[model samples]
Target: MTKTRALRLSGVALLIVGASMVVGPPASADIPFNVAVERDLGLSPRQAEARFAQQDHASAIESRLRDTLGAAFGGAHFDPSTGKLVVGVTDPAMTAVVRAAGAEATEARYSQRELDGIKSMLDETDAPAGVTGWYVDVYRNRVVVEVNRAAATRETSAYLDRLRALGPAVRVAEVTSSPRALYNVRGGDAWTTLAWRCSVGFSATGSGGSRHFVTAGHCTQGAGPAYGYNDEQMGSLGGSTFSLFGDYGKVDVTSAAWTLAGTVNRYGGGDIAVKGSTEAPIGASVCRSGSTTGWHCGTIKAKNRTVIYINGGAVGGLTQTDACAEPGDSGGSFITGTGQAQGMTSGGSGDCTDGGETYFQPVNEALTAYGLRIVTS
Candidate 1:
């Protein structure tokens, strides 16, 4: 979404009193003023306002569920667009308990049978020809396989054959793909601070050049006169806003300190080597990293989602994944089985300890928005 620039300033005036004779002229009170002024903080006031609005909506729903469902409700999450509450219940008995309490409840069950079927199909097949990994999206009720190099002649034929064998129950989709690579942050790399804990790429509109990275926009101002990782001068923010739609901030590249490498750390006791830059399908499994949460994995839930932010702004076209994240993880990278960079961390409801749904901004969109490219092996 496009954001416009705005500034917020708060001023306070104080009065002083002293014991003075009526004859003495009253002394003028010293006016004390403190301004918490944020300049070019990155997000436009409209975007910030949107985020606040979303937060209010979510909070109101959550509060109502807690008050009504009470102890019976395991938890509740609201979808802003429909304003529907996905209330979680601990057991079948709790279903009745929830309705009795005056809130709507639905059966929130993950199908082990369907999961096993998908896993079996993946294990048995040769994965067509170029396919990397297969994902079973429970939320979407579909299966997506990641393919390589746009699905060659034989690859496409083999993929169809495999799908036939997997059965019609498993509707299959193919995503032409590549692998993701990893790079270490150099001392001088430029990025947007998603949070004190996470940051991402940015471009500086100056002669110094620009670097690409990921970070949370809320961590810094929407319009930034940003600094490098080493505190060296870098660039300013190009776009920034936070929302349930997936909060992220972008910086215009000012210097070229970022160098792409050829690896993506899976954090599951292995790594995926980079080959090309291909996107994973909707149901594909993906992993991510951030300053707060080192690494975590989950399946893609949906794509092109428009999430509303707590602050009253909305972000369109976000990737929703089951991967969990925290406050500090905003703007971290999300990679797929073949190592392709899928998106960057935005925000989510849960933590690493308990697990929750997370959202991300597709990397390709960022590249296009800032006129940059993802360097691959």
Candidate 2:
């Protein structure tokens, strides 16, 4: 078993997506939307609203680029500080098209297809104990490989050598904190069993047309007859998947008294409306809702991230954030200001008080994986 030691990362600082951002106290009352934005990101209400709009604008451009560039499209991330989108492309002809679309175009050394293939190759190899996680950093235009102290021992030298031989498109850095899914904590769409407690990611209906709510696969894996904190039988887990590629689960909501909504709990603040399941761009401001943290905001650091969680095993296709989350925040809500469904909490290294980096299972990936449609308003 991998040592479940807490992560102590000094490798890469949390990429500051939106400048002038800081954490603050949760809203005691139903603060104005702008006020809520101010609390989370420290932007004036106007700036907050404008930034949200910019994210939407950026997404549209990204969509267009994806359609036009296809394989040449490396990836896209939004710049919170300047309210612009940064797009990567392998071909120079695409650069002018991207700039014309109001994005800052950069020539990328490798295509998105190349990176995906490289990442897939590494995924095939068994990761040694020293390897913490590795993911494609579209912003940096390279894959980031994370290692822990265990790799320093002579025993793991050969494994490290093999990892380095994978390619020159990646950089390995020693770090701490093996991530584990935050579980057995109390709070948020709270569900409980004799063993564990976790949050509801979002509500959905699977291909079978059964009423269900999604959550972390780690929470539902190896478990059945799951019940809510309210003590009502919520039906056993179904279609639960974990470890590699993605971590998500579906719970068939069977209780008559309980009702599913497309809304998310906002702690003391009011509920957030789920407008759609559009994925937020990298560097775009995003906030999460969990029983532990209530609500907190941060910029999306990277997308299509692959994390080898100590608890859930290994999973790819995740979104990374600097937003703080503690135990029980797993499988919670991550939504944008415009109420776009982003993802659900996956294991991360830090707590809300001191601060930490967190990852989420992209909602769209989950929806597509299970052929589940997000319950949207």
Candidate 3:
């Protein structure tokens, strides 16, 4: 496969093709990709390649299954244990159908629609700060509401009761820290405003042929002019949203000196070519690049998670991952080993040293929201 070629300019370069710790073989240009997955995820390059193909096959057929099963469609996830796709269905009759489609089928208590409805109700109601976030766990076939154990109080308990009353579809999980937006007043590769810094996500183009780069909304929201780590003005915020709508922003690359290449900086490891923006399923391996943490690999834990930050700002429709991130890592690139674009780092509690859950705003959502096309190799 053809890979993105690096573009060097004025001692600054748009890097292309870096390795990641995920289950997938990189293109021919990314030999380090296999080695990275082997070292971090503990899989041989061959094994990782096979698993990536498997997940891609599963993702490809999922839409057809959803249409065929209709309301009986509970949810679908990649089963790492079996190295196959396991689709949940509320109807027993759908089991054979799923199997016929080459996926394992399991019984589910609630359909995806039912569980989403429950989560939607929670999103509409204001929750105590003790509530960190919530998401539909496809494997469990339940909507999980995560709470900060120490932050919980009588008021939080009452709120939990109301959530539980929504029925058995709701499950509570206790976490130690609350989620927050990851803007440091900082790194995929270090872009900055006057007072804060964040990483560049993906490069893209507007419908009118304008060059731009995408990042976390919190990084660009009222943050003013964006600049490269070199302190050169790159552009201005074109669009941004950090509320229930989602956490995403676009920066028009107004500076001719800067290039909008479809690549992510892998720090000293080189770069990773962003080939596409196909969302991976939960349980799939993924890796992210940031200026603060460099590159860290992890598995996707959940999808469509709604995180309520400690500052009272809430961003819905986020994908949760086991990847570790920190302040200033916001807006970094999250990609699969195959070089597929995943998302931009939003925030989460914990550090790279201790390991913690991190959330990302899906790249596809950001692309769609802005009617922009991702620049790909």
Candidate 4:
């Protein structure tokens, strides 16, 4: 594996840094709704609350629409502008049905199945190094393939042409920077593996009632005993996955000193209660907690995205978000406004300063893969 990026330790530069040293105080406490929602989303507290309610309602009915519409169900997203959920349907016959169910329906060129097929094809084929990632943009009703123009070579150009030949359903766009795994030290509440650090995703329970915590697979891959930021031994790295399958891992919490909590560190915002693992729909408001950046909020841009990190291999079934994260923030928690567990930080293109998109391994998939259930409040 490539050497992970190191933390710059700006404001906390004076703090002692080492495996046994306390890099910074652990973030714990409770606060109201995240203030970053106002900063990042440009919404007032009341407006943000309204959006959350609308998103929750949409999530509730999303399953019904999927089962009822079947092949006609293109996808669904919350429209902040109208404060309503919009459902995409390939069959015009389903439009009225969607409206009757209290959602606005729009015609889509393809169904979710077709889009998934295209993405699956891309997943099965080897992507060029210049290609950063790709996902189905439900709003656009097309599959978006992102490429790093600056890194493009003759081979990559030929590859793009071949992808175009796949049909109009494919939309290729240029990205300025490629994503890299945000691995190293520091995060929401820093947890160390050997000398390096990463944030904890969520606490979970194993089959035999064993305590565990989830994090980025890259963070736990080939790692030894796990420890907290204060160097308190927590557990042992159990199972990890970092290839095209996904980017998630489980750490068996073997120490009695560490008590598993179902809350995510919101830095100064306090600890956000994790009530459930309900997947948020695209366009719903979401926030991230990391030791590096604290709390930052953004909206879900897409789902089931596949991102290929510069050094780390392609990881599929990730959810794309506009939230920002920095080095040492890998495995941090991502939660919805309603306190729903989303995923853990995988990697991204930009930082909290200029702002950029981040991808996460959905917590539900990770829990299912490990035969674990999230420790909820």
In model 2, which residue pairs have backbone atoms overlapping below 3 Å?
6-177, 7-176, 7-177, 8-176, 8-177, 188-291, 243-314, 245-316
Ranking by lDDT: 4, 3, 2, 1
Tens digits of lDDT, candidate 3, 198-280: 78899999899988888998777774677776667888878888988789998888988987787876655577788898878
Give stretches of model 4 more than 4 Å off: 1-22, 25-33, 185-187
TM-score of each: 0.44, 0.86, 0.89, 0.91
TM-score of 2: 0.86
Best by lDDT: 4
* Ten-residue region with minimum lDDT total, candidate 3: 1-10
Model 3 vs truth, CA RMSD: 8.1
Q: lDDT of all the models against the reference?
A: 0.46, 0.74, 0.79, 0.82
Q: Candidate 1, residues 1-377: lDDT per residue as tens digits?
A: 00111111001001101101111111211111000001111223454344324434444454665566444444444333343344555357767655554445665443324543565545554444444344444343345554444634676666666676755445545443322111113101223222122444222122233454444544444444654434444556566545432445565545555443444433333444544445554444556655444456666666654443333234445677777655445566676444557777655545566666677777766665555655455
TM-score of 1: 0.44
Which segments of model 1 are wrong by more than 4 Å? 1-197, 201-210, 214-221, 228-234, 241-249, 253-276
Better of 1 and 4 by TM-score: 4
Clash number for every model?
Answer: 57, 8, 12, 4
